[model samples]
Target: MTMTSPVALTERQCTLIARALAEPRRYQILKEIAGQGGSVACACMQQKHEVTPATLSHHMKELENAGLIEIVREGKFATLVLKRETLDAYLRELASL
Candidate 1:
């Protein structure tokens, strides 16, 4: 059996994603992650945005909790992987509503 990253969803997660997408900056972060082939690190994103580490951390946590981005930690840094399929599914479900 091949192991793959988990992609579970709940009603709350869906709602969280919908709310997260409502913010333009958050949406930009999501798009940036997707554009980077589905993953980017906090440090890299901070460099891209030229924001303070504390501010970046807060935004990252919001994105992480929304399930729009997955965090893969390595030492003191984490790589954020865009959950593209999950995001697209959420959008499709919203459109159907």
Candidate 2:
């Protein structure tokens, strides 16, 4: 799906992205999701990161708030997908400044 581009990023969006990424755990989570090249199950992330379900949920929420990732929940299963376009836009925006 198409997403907001660098030229389209608002100040609020940039701030959210920056804030979300400031967390080391979130950045590591983002890296893992990106390295996967597709969706990663929540269970998998928890296992890899050794985080509690509650903590993982909190971090995921922040990433989602920043538009950096999308989480799809089906029944008890949850999968996360990185929003590459958003990330690329954020990076481009930073470089442009």
Which pairs of residues collide in model 2?
none
Give per-residue CA lDDT, model 1, range 29-95, as digits (tens). 8889988899887788888887788877777788888878888999998899987878877876777
Provide the TM-score for each candidate, comma-separated.
Answer: 0.82, 0.90
On TM-score, the candidate that comes out on top is 2
Q: Distance (Å) between predicted and true CA of 50, model 1?
A: 2.7
Per residue, candidate 2 scores C-alpha lDDT tens digits across 1-97 of: 9974344689999999999999999999999999999579989999988878899999999999999999999999999999888898899898888
Model 2 alpha-carbon drift over 4 Å, by segment: 1-7
Q: Name the 10 consecutive residues with the lowest summed lDDT in model 1.
A: 4-13
- lDDT at residue 93 of model 1 (Cα atoms): 73
TM-score of 1: 0.82
- Each model's lDDT: 0.82, 0.91
**For model 1, which pairs clash?**
none
